[model samples]
Target: MKIPSEMSERIKELAEAISEAERVRVITHIDADGLSSAGIICSILHKEEKQFSVKAIKQLDKDNISELFSNMRSDLLILTDLGSGQADKLPKNKGVCIIDHHQPVSSEILQLNPHFFGIDGSREVSSSGLCYLVAREMGYRDLSPLAIVGAVGDNQDSRGELLGLNKEILKEAEKEGLVIVEKDIRIFGRQTRPLFKALEYTTNPYLPGISGSERGAIEFLEEIGVPLKRGDKWVRLVDLTEEEKKKVLTGLVMRIVKTGGSVESAKVLVGEVYTFPAEKGMLRDAKEYSTLLNACGRRGFPGVGIAVAMGDRNENLRKAESILDEYRREVSEAIELLQKEGLKEKGILKYFLAGDRIRDTVIGTVTSMLMGRREEVLVGMANSENGKVKVSARTTRELTNKGVNLGIALRRAAESVGGDGGGHSVAAGAKIPRGREMDLIEFLEKEIERQVNEIDG
Candidate 1:
């Protein structure tokens, strides 16, 4: 594909770096979006027959950074989805190219994010869209399918619109028959799976019965006699009997409009199951890869996730499944811990600590799950693999309506403690140095208090 004339210079620079480098290393975040971004780059490298390795990391800590720098055989390192912050920790090597959409920590890093051009990086555009920019620069338009997958994985299309280059790429993908664009309502409330299996997978709209057990969810579905699956295997809600459908539909009335701009209504249907055909043995049939990849990262073995995204098969798939099961178990246990310990609601900050094993990957999901229970801002913190404190902050539209920006507050708080953090204004995260967890929490509390006071005053 021809490079967009506007980004031609930057694209040329990236291509030159790739052509000149002896070895290349790609690092990305450990979520579905991150994996999809990594997959796009990896696919390009594979087609070009370039020597490279991919690493999926939860957070760029001192140990991981040190290991990456020490083992650096590549003349160039490309970081995607992450690395907007940590400019200080960025490898000093001359051959570094970063493609991301997050708000950067400093002007120098900010200049690298495509959003600086007034492009919407939040959901309208994603890290994958940014990577698509890089690919367009490299003259590989054929890889746009990978870019679309990354965008979708990142929830970029949840609102029924695509922004910036993503729209252009979607048009291209549609022309190539790689993607089918349709106007449809995606149901985010209640799973049609069995109670035990729903608890195991923790699919949205359906919290497990053990932790935030939605008794209403189980009763409504059971009274309707809808057969729920054991695991996350998709079941058609439309397949249920007419009476069961009415009961299940009647019970799923709690509308969960996320504050970060996903404000769609949910509808209960009896025979409206939508499926995507599998792409090259990957579970493209399932639209939940984003959640699955996140579970993999939270449970450990982020590399297994990278392998799956990179299209590894056989043993790699088995390992990924095993790791995901362990992740479910850990999440169940963590929810139990959160319930016993309970969460504290202080002004705009609602939080609970789930010991050292919970980590940041699960925080976002858990926080979103708890949103139905409370209308306050949500913040969940856990310890990282390096013993440092990891924090994920989320807010509802109610809070955003008051002009509260959790991302800015969390970034400032994390930086005040000499840590790295930044994300969208509605949702964000940070990793503080070990032993500074309380300091970070206190800082966030004060910031939230200040924001509320300023608005009220």
Candidate 2:
């Protein structure tokens, strides 16, 4: 796994810029990848004895961008995991560097996005990976695990494995003995939860009747001839035999097909599972580590996530673990709400209006989980502060290949309604003024249909 020379040179230049700055101000998103990116850069800067300040935000909008320039306290500004798509809105003489993996708009600001080098920013690399490359150029290769965590958090490993620059970072982590990768059942909570609980919580492959039902998961396991317990000890996915694992996987595929899901969706169930040997409990697995970070951020404790990623395990890790429990409960409650109150359909899209019932931060995650159960694009909306609505949309990889870019569509729709939005093709988000949800949905439907029709022609 060799680094592209051009990208490597760009990373060196960014490292030089960071070294030359007297003081740095970092603004990162309030998500796992964003927090992971902040942890890497902040740790490196601290080691280098550089003065820096950091802030974690939910999104980059006009008000925050204005505040960033008005209250300037540092010689340089670094926006990680975000800001590439909003580059044009940033000031020109502010000494800004956008270290992100999202698609970039034309701007004069310095950016280290993989999209500029013909790399698939959505799938190949993430903001954390880009930041890790900068850290590597600065002689800090041991931070590879954080990069892997960020990539997994961003769902760049949707193919059940890391690819492109992410794979390159994984190789570095392997060399440092920080991460070990293997093929296994790709579900949440393999390291922390019981076997049936893990099966009940699976979402990517999204077991139809078993996913949200504890009894269903138990019955499915029993039907597959895999005992729920071995002589009084409950079975974990980690404790399954090779033959038993195959049986469970086969059962999963059959369940998906029986529920009208494509066989290709079930293929994601058995792929690379990343283990962080140096970490304990849930932190040992890359996906679970990312989930912990997400829990911290969504629970309004982004600092705790950053601290855990920066090697803090005393109070911060305990707080993060506590937050994870609460986050899971909130997520389950939100999902139950969706199940009780079905989504509204418009053309090829299905949407739900949470209207303050669901937290805006959790809407994107909730929408992603529900996407596996439907053929139409899933859109979720929740009330935000300042009388705004936050919208998160998700679609299948199959539809993305059919030229349905939710990022572009949502951006256009948001701007039409005087809002802002941008993200990957499969997942995107927006925040629009209140009383405009209907307008946004209508425009989004047209945009998605147009994209598909153009491709069909």
Candidate 3:
């Protein structure tokens, strides 16, 4: 839980820089973690009455970087959730700051990242957690809940519970009475949706027939002797008794195994659920809150997500609910389309080209949801604006443990094809020319094979 002395000192320096800046311009990724990071920094800046502006971007690529800062006026620029991998592209004329957890390229800019201190950024902490450490150094620790939400959003809790610095942040949230951590069913929408709907909507584990099947979920519950409702009201997961919960968990594992899924899929079924009592509906639960943030950000409403994270529960929350419905529908439809069309397998990867059928902004989310369905690394691609292709790649912890670095591979592969990419060992992304999808895939296939063989060699 103790912050490394060097990391702590770095955070302190960043805090000081923020305090001294006359006007700050913040550019963050347009995802849950990025939005949460933006929310945390912006909330503190708002409290201090500092002049600041924010832009949520899909990716910190060349055109994006040039457009976002060509006419920069702020005294300081802070890039959150992103900018570590593209540090060289950042403007050098201004005081640039990077608070991110992605794998970093060498840079001289003022930055704070966990990887620099021998920590696993992918699983240990998230960009939001790093932002919270800065907030803590700035004497604002109440933002811990947002940090936890970001961690969850990044799937840092893949083991069903947070680890490393995230666990430390959870402690801060708990101590401040802002969060309640409990071990419970780790399905989506546990706080708001009915039990059948929650089971039907879960795609992380891609639960056999239950996922994407309302009738299947209901039948599974009924077959397990769990009642569908309590006195005519459909029960939520929270409404179940301890005995019924155990039965459901057991049934879920059995169902997954029976349908050819690894028991490992069930690892994510039950874990620590962080609840914020002060917040209502989906915002009260860390997973659901993070999902809501993702819904807003991915659907081109990053401001709504940021506002909700900054404690706006009226207009922004209302807008976010609609976005959530749309986002979920799109995700379900995308998954069904992918499943129906099938994935293409190469030497060491399974991939699909959405060809703009899926939005570029949500391709990564789709790729993640499609992870547990296969053993090979999954690569998802979608056509982007301006004749570009967006690529999102994901691998399991097992493959990562076997020395499969998607970040390094994708970075090298993208660079070879006149693009840029890098992230964590397990998950990464890139952007390339429109017709270069196959080139990217070919490069990844060879690189992954070499990586796997090198570890064995």
Please tell me which predicted candidate would have the highest TM-score against the true structure. Answer: 3
- For model 2, the stretches where C-alpha displacement exceeds 4 angstroms are 201-205, 208-216, 257-261, 373-375
> lDDT tens string, model 1, 1-457?
3334545566566767776776789988877778778877777787678999988877664556777777667877888888775655676667677777776654333224655555657666778666766666677766565666667656555445555677877777667665655433233222343442443354443333422344644564565566565356544532445575455445443323332212222321121222334353224423445555665666666677667766676777778767766666666666666656878866556777755657567877666555533346777887765567778887654676676767678888998897877777667888888777778888988987787778888
Candidate 2 on 1-457: residue-level lDDT in tens?
5777888788998999899998998999889999999999999989889999888998897756897777687888899999988999989964789998887787999899998898988899999999999999899998999999999999888888999989988987898888898888888888777889988866555577787679989999989999888888888998999999889999999998886677766777878999989888888988888988988998899999999999997999999989987887788778778877977899889999999899999998888877654357989999999888999998887789899998889999999999999988888888999999999999999999999999999
Best by lDDT: 3
Query: Per-residue lDDT of 1-457 in model 3, one digit per residue for the tens?
Result: 5889999899999999999988999899999999999999999899888999998988888767888778778888999999999988777764888999999987789889999999999999999999999888888988899999999999999898899999888987898899999999899888788899999878776777787788989999989999888998989999999999999999999988886567776778888999999999889989889989998999999999999999999999999989988888788788889878988999778999999699999999999877765357999999998889999999987888788999999999998898888999999999998898899999999998899889999
Q: lDDT, candidate 3, residue 9?
A: 91
| Residue-level error in angstroms, candidate 2, position 112 | 0.7
For model 3, how big is the CA root-mean-square deviation? 1.5
Predictions in order: lDDT = 0.63, 0.88, 0.89
What lDDT is reached at residue 74 by model 3?
87
Give the residue spans of candidate 1 off by over 4 A.
1-9, 61-67, 88-92, 107-112, 136-142, 157-167, 182-202, 206-219, 225-235, 238-249, 254-282, 357-360, 373-375, 449-457
Clash pairs detected, candidate 1: 194-228, 194-229, 238-270, 238-271
| Worst 10 contiguous positions by lDDT, candidate 1 | 265-274
Q: Where's the lowest-lDDT run of ten residues in candidate 2? A: 367-376
